[model samples]
Target chain A: MSETRQINVSKSQVPKLAIIALGIIFAAGLFVVGFDQGHIFSLVYGEQAFTDMYLHELTHDMRHAAGFPCH
Target chain B: MKTSLFIIIVLLSGAFAGLIHGTVNFAIVEPYLDQAIGIENQNLFASGEEEDTTEFWVEYEGYRTWQKSGQILAGMILGISVGALFGIVFALSRNALPGNNDVKKSLILSGIMWLTLYIIPFLKYPANPPTVGDGETVVLRAILYLSFIAISGFGAVGFYQLSKKLKDNKKIIALVGYGVFISAVFIAMPENPDELTAPMDLVNEFRFMSVLGVTSFWASIGIILGLFWRKLSSQKETTHYN
Candidate 1:
C-alpha cells in the first residue's frame, strides 16, 4: 500500500476588513489635514464653525507646506 | 496576515514616518513660513485691514503657536492617511513586485507612487507659501490640482495594467504612452491663477523645502513598513514539525 503525505499549511486570504478600515482612515485623515476649512467642525458647530475654522487654523502651516489649497 | 495586526502595522508605520516628515519641516520649512507670514502681516497692516496693536500681536502669537504645534500632529495624521494607501497597495502587489526581500519591493512601489501621486502633480501645481494663494480662487485651484493628480495617477496605472498584457519587448510602449498622455494633460491644465507676488527667491526656497519634507515621508514609510512586513510575514510562514 502507498501512503500519502499531507503538509499542514495555511493560505492567506485577501484582507478586505483591513483594507476597508484603512480606506476610511485615508479619506478622513486627508480631509482633516488637507481641506477641512471648518467643514468637519461644521457638522457639530453649525455655521459658526466656518468662522472659527479651528482645524483649518491649526493645520494652516502644514496645508500650505504640503501643497493644499489654503487661504 | 491577520486583519488587526495588518491595520496596526500600517497605522503605526504611517505615524512614525509622518512624525519624521513633521520634524523635518520644523527644522527646514518653518523659517520660510514665518517669513511669508511676516509679509502677509505687513500687507494687512499696510492695507489698514488691522491696526498693529498689542492686542493684534497677542492674537497672532496665540494662533501662530497653535499652527506650529499642529504641524507635528498634522504630519502624523497625513502620514497615516497616505500610509494607509501605501499599505493597501503594498499588500496587494507584493508578489508582483520584484526583490528578494519585502524592503526592496516596498521601496520600488513607494518611488513609483511618489512619482505618480506626488511629483507629477507637484510639477503641474507646485507648493505655494501663504502669500501666494488667493482666497477667491482657492476652490478652483483645488479642483484643478486634484484633477491633475487623479489623471496622472490613473493614467500611469491604466498604462501599467495594459503593459502586463503586452509582449515583454513591447512593454516600453506603455512608458511612452504615459509620458505623452501626461504631457498633453500638463499643457491642457490651466496655470495657477494666483499671480506670484512673493519674492521669487522666497517662493522657490519654500518649494524646495516642501519637496524635501514630503520626500522624507515616502522614504521612511517604505523602509519602516517593509521591515515590519518582512518580520511578520516570516512568522506567518514558519512551519512546525510535530
Candidate 2:
C-alpha cells in the first residue's frame, strides 16, 4: 500500500484593489507636487488660479530641487 | 494578507521619509534656492519686469516664506505617493529579491530603483535651480524628463523579467543587456532646449545638494518599510513570509 501526502500552502496573493489605490495616489501626488502649474486650482477658481498659482508657489522649491522643470 | 496594515505602514514610512527629505533640503538646498532666486530677482529688475521697491520686496518675502514652508508639506505628499509605489513593488517582488532578511532586500530594491529611476535620468537631465529653466520650454522639458524616467524604470523591469527566464549563471547577460539598452536610449534622447544662464558653480552645487535630499528619502523609506515588513509579517498572518 502506498500513502499520498497532502499539503496546503498560501502564497498570499497581493490585492489588486490595493495596487490600484496606490497607483492613483502616486499619480495624483506626483502631478500636484512635480507638475502642477495652477491647473488643479483652475477647476474651482477659473483663470484667476493661473495668476495666483497657490499650489505651484507652495511646491516651488521642491519642484526645482527634485529635478522637475520649473520657470 | 493584512491589507489595511500594509497600506498604513507604507504611508507612514513614506511620510516619515519625506519629512526627513524636506528637512534636509531646508537645511542644505534652501541656500542654493535663495541664491538662484536672487539672480532671478536681479534679472527681473534689469528687464523692468519687477521693480526693486518696498512693495515688491514685501510681496517677494511673503511668497518666499510660503514656498519654503511648502517644501515640507510637499515632501510629505510626494513621499506618500512614491512610497505607495515602492510598497507595491516590494510586496510583489519580495519572494525573488536577494537578501537574508527583509531590511536587506528592501535596501537592495531601493538601490536598484534609485540608480535606474533617479541616477540614470539625472545624468541626462540634471536638476536645475530657479533662473535656469526657460518658461517657454518648461513643458517640453518636463515631458522629456518624465519620458526618460518611464523608459528607464520599465526597461529595468523588462530586463529583470528576462533574467528570470535564464539560468543563474546567465543572469549577467540581463544586466549587460539593460546597460546597452539604456545607454542607447540616453544618446537618442533630445537635449534640453534651454540655455544655462546660471553660474556653473552654483548650478553644480545645487545639483549636489538635490542629490543628497533625494538619496535621504530613498534610504529612509527602505529602512522604515523594511522594519515594518519584518515586524508585521508574522507567520500566522502571512504564511509565505515563513
Candidate 3:
C-alpha cells in the first residue's frame, strides 16, 4: 500500500496577507508622496481652514527632478 | 532564498542604489536650479517685466538644503516602494517567463518598466525645470502626461492578453497592436502650446539630466538586486546541505 504525502497549506497564507497589506500601504504612500501635493492632511482631518502648501513646496523639486510633471 | 527574504534583499539593495542616484543629482543638478532662477529672472526682464520684482526665489528660503536632502529621501522611498511592487510582479510572472537566472529576468523587466513608465512619457513631455512654463497650464500638462503613461501601460497589458490568444506570430501581433495603440494616443494627445518660460538650453539640459538620473537609479537597482539575490539564493542552497 502506497501512502500519500500531505502538504501543509496554511503556512503560505501569512505571506500573501502581508503582501496585500504592504501593497495597500505602499500604494497609499505612493499617492501621498507623488500625487497628493496639497489638501491631503486637511482632507484627513476634515478641517475647513487648515490649508497648507508646505507639502506641495517640499515635494516640488523632487517632483520635477524625478521627471513627473510639475510645470 | 525564500521569496520574502529575496524581496527584502531586493528592497534594501534598491534603496541603497537609489540613494546613490539621488546623490548624483544633488551634486550635479541642484546648482542648475539656482542658475535657472537667475535665467528665468532675466527672461522676465527681457519681457519688459521688473527683474528683481518676481519674488519667486525669495518666497522660498532654505530650499537649497531642503532639495539636497529631499532628493535622497525621495530616492530611497521610491526605490524600496517600487522595488517591492517589482518583486511581487516578478514573483507572479516568473513561471511564465523563460529564464532560470533571476537577475537577467529582473534586468529585462526593469528595462520594460523604464520604457513604459518613464521613457515613453518622458519623450512626449520631457521633465520641465522649475519656472519653465505658465502655471495656468500645469493641470493640462499633467493630464496629458498621465494619459500617455496610462495608454502605454494598458497597451502593454493588451498586448500580453492578445499574445496569449493568438496561435501564430503572437509577438508580431502584440508588437503591432502596442505600436499602433501608442502612436494613435500620442497623435491624439494635446500638446502644450504655451511659450517656454525658461531658457531652452537649460530646459533641454535639465530634461536630459533628469532622465539620465532615473535611468541610473533603475539600472543600479536591477544590478544591485541581481547580485544580492544571487548571493542569498546561493547561501540558501548551502544551508540546505547542512
Candidate 4:
C-alpha cells in the first residue's frame, strides 16, 4: 500500500510571504503612479504625509548607512 | 487570505490618504506663509518689477517640478519600507505565547519607545520646532498630532502581539490595530471638496515634491532594516536546527 504524506507549512512563512508581497505591491504601485503625473500632483497632501513617515524611516537608514546603526 | 489582502489594501490606502491630506494643507498654508513673510510672489524673494516677477515665476516652476518628482519617489520608498518592517516584525514574533503579555504592556513599551526616540529629540530641539512649514494649517496640525499618537499606539500593540508568538487571526488583529492607527490621520483631517476647485495660484509644486522625496527616502530605509533584522534571525534559527 502506498501512503501520501502531507507537507505542513510553518507559521513563520506567512510573515515572510506578506513582506515580499508588500514589497512587490509597493514597487508596482509606484510604477503605475509614476506614469500619471497629474494623479501624482492631485495626491500631493497625501504624498506629504507619506513623506513624513518616509523621513522617519530614511533617518534610520542614514544612520545605518553612516555605520552608526540603531534598532 | 482575504484578511491578508485587506490588511495590505488598508495600509496602501492609509499612505494615499496621508498624501491627499498633506497636499491640501500645503496649498492652504502657502498663502499664510506668504502673508507672514510679506512676499507678493509665491517665491520667497520678490524684486518689485514685472520682469523680475516673470523670471522668479519661471525659476519657481522649475523648482516645483523637481520637488514633485522627489515626493513621488519618496512615497513609494516609504510604503515599501513600512510594509517590509511590518512583515519582519510579524515573522519574528510568530511563536509568542499568548496571555504572557497583554496589550497594556505593549502600550507602555510603545510610550517608552516614543519618549526616547521622538519626544526627547523634539524636547531638546524645542527652539528648532519641526514645523510642517507651509503645510501647517489648523486641520493639518490636528491630524498630524492625532495620527502620531494613533500610529505609535497601534504599532506598539502590533509589535507586542508578534513578540508574544500569536498566529493566524491574532496577527491579522494586530495588523488591523496598526491600520486603525494609520487611518486616524484621514479621520481627523478629511478634505473639503470645495477646496479642490480653488486656484493653485499660491502653491509651489517643486518645493512640495522635494520635501516629499527626501522624507520618503529616509523612511524606506528604516523599514528595510527592520525586515532585514527579522530575516537574519530566522535564517540563524534554520541553520541551528539543520
Best by lDDT: 2
For each candidate, what is the lDDT? 0.90, 0.92, 0.68, 0.37
Write candidate 1's Cα lDDT for B1-242 as tens digits.
Answer: 67888899999999999999999988999999999999999999999998999999999999999999989999999999999999998888888788888899999999998898999999989999988899999889989988998899889889989999999999999999999999999999999999998999999999999999999999999999999988776433344444
lDDT-wise, the better of 2 and 4 is: 2
Candidate No. with top DockQ: 1
Over 4 Å off, model 2: A1-11, B235-242
Q: What's the DockQ for every one of the candidates? A: 0.45, 0.40, 0.26, 0.06
Clashes of 3: 0
Q: Quote the positional error of residue A22 for candidate 3 in Å.
A: 4.4
List runs of model 4 lying over 4 Å from the truth: A1-14, A17-71, B1-14, B20-53, B65-80, B90-118, B124-242
Model 3's alpha-carbon lDDT is: 0.68
Docking class of 4: incorrect
Query: Which CAPRI category fits model 3?
Result: acceptable
The number of residue pairs in model 2 that clash at the backbone is 0
Residues B100-213 of candidate 4: C-alpha lDDT, one tens digit per residue:
332323233323443432342222211111112222343343334334544554566556556358765576665565556545543554442122211343233323432343
**Residue by residue across A1-71, what tens digits does model 4's lDDT show?**
55555443333345455666666765455333222223343466565544343333323222111111112
TM per prediction: 0.94, 0.94, 0.79, 0.31
RMSD of 1: 2.8
What C-alpha lDDT, on a 0 to 100 scale, does residue B107 get in candidate 3? 74
